[model samples]
Target: MLRRNLPSLFRFSSSASASKPVNEEKSRSVGRKAVSTALFCLTGGVALSALDDLAIYHGCSSKAMEKASKNQEVVHAIGEPVVKGPWYSASLAVAHKRKSVSCTFPISGPQGSGVLRLKAVRSGDDSWSTFFQSRDFQILILDAVLYVPGNEETQRNVKINIADNIPSPSSQACTRCPETRSPGKQ
Candidate 1:
């Protein structure tokens, strides 16, 4: 009778050990899943960064640079074909829903270097526009702040308006603002 009880005790112990292995296997699988998820998220973020860089390289920034480069005033302040600086030295602000952008970038030429400030708005609601769309930014206002090295204020370092698309002073009438002067109103 004692021997029969011993076998039964051994059987119960074996079943308990088997359940522990199953629990361990489940915990390992959960850990592996967590690591895989983290890796996927990291890769997605890296891809988006690469995409933004590519867009900045070939999109609205380039177009704004082209417009600024073409201006005679900008050319005189900086240099002709006003390009050739590192890409990382620019600031970009994008208004997602309103489809507007404000950009400031460093520009240099044979004579000197300056900062370009530009504000632009998309002409129409485009079907393919996302956060970083660059194709439709019509430049509304462009200004170049030149920094003249080894010269006086008269020689350089003045802000030049490259392009202006603001409303004419004669038509600025916002009834809500009491300080705003309108046409035919003092």
Candidate 2:
């Protein structure tokens, strides 16, 4: 009986020892899974960042286009001003007897107030030579559309105000040249 009991106890301890290796294998598999998941997430994040950078480099990102689509206001033809109330007002007109186009807009927001004036001349070939002006700088644009972002309330309040044609005090100085050449000379 002692001999039989000894063999049974030996079998029990041997089985417990065998299970230790299985437990270790299971823990190793779990660690491998955790590492795999981390690597997959890291690769995906890097790929997404690269795509975003590419989009921005190409001019308009998906995020920016999405925002622009949501906020864009289109003005059709001269004399049709796009007014977004309490936020901005924009108007386009043909000036100098249809030889030039003028686009004017006023911006008001938490940042401050300023006016944007754009002037374009029709070339002999029917193309446009455009100029853009803001408080900070002036630039020439071959062809471009201006976009201003605003909320629904401000857009709703916008209307066609003829007074917008009147230049602001700051702009008056630049637009007027002291009536130098006599009012009827040219």
Candidate 3:
């Protein structure tokens, strides 16, 4: 009888080793799940960043364009073709004319703001030239569409008001309120 019971005990120990095989398979499955979860997180992070850039561009484009359009007379009167560089650049010597300057506000991404410089050339007898460099890295994509008032050699009697900087998700508006002024020029 003792021998019969001993064989049964050995059988129980053998069944325990059978579980080792299933344990190995479960470990592998867990590893696979972890890898896939990590991949999903990385892809989601990239997509979110792209969406942020698109939002910023769209929100700022229209407002900036409107402001620049209002200053079109100045651009037509004083702006000279910015030759020798990209079409985006325009040199303008806005003397006594309204001028709206758009600056690339840095998004504070890893690549900081790329190089941006605008120049201006005055028109007249022995006209001079100057570079708009006060806020070198503050201007982004700028378009100076000229809208000249009829029959004017140059527009010198309009008000030049640069639109306020559009704050980003990471930035805040002015701490103190700017002095209020009457809406468009009277």
Candidate 4:
């Protein structure tokens, strides 16, 4: 009995059992770290998405859409009103330190569907940027192009100018969009 008990005491099986808890503890720590990292990434992604949505809604994007809706030509071409397209299909370009914004998005109505492209420049100081008010950031130059399919596809550029400056009939597109030239010029 003494000889059998002595062999058992010196056996490596006892040492292996002692180290099992340490290995399990190490694995638990690794799992915790992985979970923490996943949570952190999820939080960051949510925050960025919220910020993007906020910027889109409170910026010139909404202002341009609002101005388009009020235009009778746009209403007649597109039909009853405005309907925004899928978020993934829409594109937004912001430049000049957020003073300029260009938006291209799909819109539909009861009678027709088309793409709307608009560029707007912000006026006045951004001193009240911290305050979220639509009144603060005025849209200085809001111009849009509409493609309406009538008997044939008709392209119309609506240069909706603020600051009491009316768009001349010869200028079909805004200077901001360089691709288009004034009529009889090019």
Candidate 5:
């Protein structure tokens, strides 16, 4: 009787041990699948973020090009007022041999009363060459017109500003140089 019972006991212990390993293996497989899914999601999110940034950069680049192209044209030829900012607006109209720029600003406020400076450069040039500047002698009026001594034959890029003071661009330090130097120096 004892020998018969011993065989049955060994059979039961072996089956229990076998089933335990199978259960543990199933759990490990489930864990591995979860880790893989998480990794995939993280990688996809990063890729989408990079794509969004690239699209934004391209859009901004295109807009900047459009603005530059528009600026290259004579303001008066377009028959529309090009507003520089909330404080000022400008328009261009041809009269005889001169190009007249009509700039309007608010008649009230600290910024309202200032010397209006007009600057221009030849179209398609990065350098602010062909320098033409004039001060609006009449500070009491809401509208001021500046005359550029050129006809429609002369294409230019125009910029307008209203300020109590105008600082020289050369007065600032050159970004190309490591140290600040006099305007005369390279």
Candidate 6:
């Protein structure tokens, strides 16, 4: 019995003092701390990048669109506002040689949104350009016009209506317009 238990005793004794030398243990601990810190920083950077992308996706909100429409120049220049990824687009109509003409708005989104960055760049001798940049930081150009109804200020700013033109008929005038006859007269 004594011989059999001797091996068990040795195993117990080896397990009892597993601590390494003081200096070696301290160095290992410091290395682990460094690794932990680096991992934390990397994770934080990734999270911030994701938040920026999300903020850019929302684009311009209802209020900004209203304000732009109120001003005659902005209204006339206002082209299509696009909702693609992290960019919303609108154009500005400004006189040539104007130092600067642009409208910027704030973006609201899933986490920590930011102000939109708008700018007008000279496209050609005859053309002026405008763009809207999202928080995720991308630029888009205007291609179509968004229409709204009612002249009232209350209704003007509100996006109650949006006009989406139908695609050109396969053949010219192929589709019929709605009947104009009065309900009872018809």
Best-performing candidate as measured by lDDT: 1
Q: What's the best-to-worst order under lDDT?
A: 1, 4, 2, 3, 6, 5
Candidate 3: where is the Cα deviation over 4 Å?
A: 1-21, 73-161, 164-186
All candidates: TM-score: 0.65, 0.28, 0.34, 0.56, 0.31, 0.29
Q: Across residues 1-186, which tens digit of lDDT does each residue of candidate 1 receive?
A: 999999999899999999999999999999999999999999999997668655744566777788777677667766676884666787777676546778788888877888888887765664546546655568888777887676464565768776545443334576664586778986
Q: Across residues 70-165, which tens digit of lDDT does each residue of candidate 2 receive?
A: 322323111133332231254545444444545544433332233344444443332233211111111222122333345765433322212223
lDDT of candidate 5 over 1-186, digit per residue (tens): 999999999999999999999999999999999999999999998996555433333332233223322431223322234333233242222222222222322111112221122322112322335212321222211212323334677643334332224432434456675687889998
Clashing pairs in 3: 92-120, 103-138, 103-139, 103-140, 104-138, 104-139, 104-140
Model 1 misplaced stretches (Cα beyond 4 Å):
1-15, 42-46, 53-57, 123-134, 151-155, 164-186
Model 4 weakest 10-residue run by lDDT: 155-164
Tens digits of per-residue lDDT, candidate 6, 1-186, equal: 999999999988776655545668899999999999999999998996555333333332332443333333323322333222223442332333432334344332222222333433333332323222332212232112233333576233222122224322232366678879887894
lDDT of 4 by residue, 1-186 (tens): 999888888786778887998999999999999999999999998996566545754465566667767666667666776776775687777676556666777777775666666666665565646434443345555544555555644545343232225643444464564587669896
Question: Whose TM-score is greatest here?
Answer: 1
Candidate 5, residue 52: the lDDT equals 40
Error in Å for residue 94 of model 2:
38
lDDT of 3 by residue, 75-162 (tens): 3443432112222332222223223333332111121111222322223232223221121122334433223333566432333334
Residue 120's lDDT within candidate 1 is 77
Q: What is candidate 5's local distance difference test score?
A: 0.39
Lowest lDDT block of 10, candidate 3? 106-115
TM-score of 6: 0.29
Kindly provide the TM-score of model 2 when superposed on the true structure, using C-alpha atoms.
0.28
